[model samples]
Target: MPSGRPSGRVPTAEEGKKPGARSIPPGLAPRPRAVPDYVVKYPAIRSPRQREGYKGVFQDQLAEYTELLGEVRTAQRRLRETEAAMGRLPRHATSRTRVSRGRDSAFLEKQQRCEYLKKKLTHIKARIQEYDRDARDSAVYF
Candidate 1:
């Protein structure tokens, strides 16, 4: 077996600086600094809110984004529930009874609502992105 001990003689310049080799001094290795939990929890939002006019616009966009995000989540949950309910109800009948028709109509209504909410959410997200770009551009100018 090969010995694990270092042959501790410093090389002269004529035989030094081998390719892909490092020469870190003994006991001088860098230690990792510990990051605070608060910093991780509340990492800075890197938007253009530092500027004057763009701050309000960015804030408005952020607020709208939060609101729409909540609405989208609710819509998604309700859509799932509605779809489940629709699946539980009878899809076809021998005759078009009033109860069956009502159930089908309710299902169709929920499907329409789900589609509408999805489209609205997409539009809101696009607007938020546009506002973010605008804010960044304005900040660059100032």
Candidate 2:
């Protein structure tokens, strides 16, 4: 009788080697580095026309940013005016003295304007980010 239990097959020479003798483990191998498909297929200068278009779009975005900055400045001025008007109200000891409706309305209006301006600024900032993304994407080439 055989000393070892009989199996259907015997191990191959490579599999019979010591663990350290194997160049790579059964489950592990160096992965092949991947190259971007676009870079592999196309030259860097393939789209000059598209690059020009992106530059034009970027310039337009710069102009829009300037306009938004101006609007922000105007909003700041309006806010300052409202604050100054609020400051002018008398701080008197008379309990019976009522604040004027006109002043209160003005103050509310100014607050609303400031809020609107802040929202507008946020919108403009989002637009700027979109423009930047577009510019970046357009600049990328194979």
lDDT of each: 0.55, 0.55
**lDDT of residue 134 for candidate 2:** 68
Model 2 C-alpha lDDT per residue in residues 31-122, reported as the tens digit of each score: 88876433333223234474455455546556665666566567667767755666676656332235342345655565555554454444
Query: Which prediction has the highest TM-score against the true structure?
Result: 2
Q: Give the poorly placed runs of model 2, Cα more than 4 Å off.
A: 1-46, 91-142
Poorest 10 consecutive residues by lDDT, candidate 1: 93-102
Q: How close is candidate 2 to the true structure, as a TM-score?
A: 0.31
Candidate 1 residue-wise lDDT at 33: 92
Residue 64 lDDT in candidate 1: 61
